[model samples]
Target: MATFWIVIIAIVALLLGTVLGFFLARKYMLTYLKKNPPINEQMLRTMMMQMGQKPSQKKINQMMRSMNNQFDKK
Candidate 1:
């Protein structure tokens, strides 16, 4: 009976640790990504140039703002 109770307690602790770890990892990634976005103005400009569009400063700023707004909405 003591062994059975120990097993149950161990299983419960393992599950709780797994749940806590998942949320902590998720929160860390979200904050990291927010601080260091995968895309930046230079990359966006290069992409536009490759697509045959001459990227202007105004256009780049507009695109950046729109992208940030989209992320904010999420």
Candidate 2:
């Protein structure tokens, strides 16, 4: 009976640890990504210029919106 309780406690602890670790990792990644986004306005502008197009404020905003929408879709 004592061994049974010990086994049950161990299993429960393992599950709790797994759940906590998952949430912690998720929060850390979110904070990191927000601080260092994969793309930025300047990079977009540079790309457009490289492609032989003038970067305008309106185009930049549109591209940002589209990128955000795609991220939201995921």
List lDDT for all candidates, in order: 0.96, 0.92
- Residue pairs with backbone overlap in model 2: none
Report the C-alpha lDDT of model 1 over 1-55, residue by residue, as the tens digit. Answer: 9999999999999999999999999889989989999999999999999999999
User: What shift in Å separates residue 60 of candidate 2 from its native position after superposition?
Assistant: 1.2
**Per-residue alpha-carbon lDDT of candidate 2 for residues 1-74, written as tens digits (9 for 90 to 100):** 99999999999999999999999999898778767879999999999999999999999999999987886665
- Cα TM-score per model: 0.90, 0.70
Give Cα distance to truth, residue 44, candidate 1, Å.
0.4
Best model number under lDDT: 1
